[model samples]
Target: MKVYLDNVGERRLIGRADVPSEAGPVWIVRLFGSALIIKEHYTIGTVTHVPDGGARPLMERAVLLARGQPPELLPGWQALAP
Candidate 1:
């Protein structure tokens, strides 16, 4: 899946991480330049531009938590897991 980060003027390709699933399935999305980490749970999403470097981990966790769920869609777009 590809995500566009308009703020950074770049596009991010999202895919599954190439690791064993003893932990569980995970979904990953990456964007270059001015990296900002965002996590969404339920209806609310949060964004963190700090340099703590926790975005990837948080996204993986979100995927695990959302396993077996249907995709989410807004008015004009849909969010599908990869």
Candidate 2:
């Protein structure tokens, strides 16, 4: 899925990820221009642990956005265009 930094003056195209259909809440946290995106993955009949305040981690990706890139978004979450 196409990701973006939404706290800046102009929206910045950060990066993307391959989130599954059963992916739950997508949590993103940023600091000093760096960000960590955590996607909850699960199946229809499967169970998974949630990312708690103090835990190892779940399936996630760390994206470092460029400080000079312009903000843009794709047409859809699973789209390749930007």
Best by TM-score: 2
Models 1 onward score TM values of 0.20, 0.25
The whole-model C-alpha lDDT of candidate 2 against the native structure comes to 0.36
Model 1: residue 12 alpha-carbon error in angstroms: 10
Q: After superposition, how far is residue 37 of candidate 2 from its true place, in Å?
A: 16
Candidate 1 lDDT, 1-82, residue by residue in tens = 2222222433232332222334233333323454455433221222324347555433322122233232232112234465
Q: How many residue pairs clash in all the candidates, one count each? A: 0, 2
RMSD (Å) per prediction: 16.2, 14.7
Weakest lDDT window of 10 consecutive positions for candidate 2:
39-48
Per-residue error for 28 in candidate 2, Å, reads 9.4
Please give the lDDT score at residue 26 for candidate 2: 38
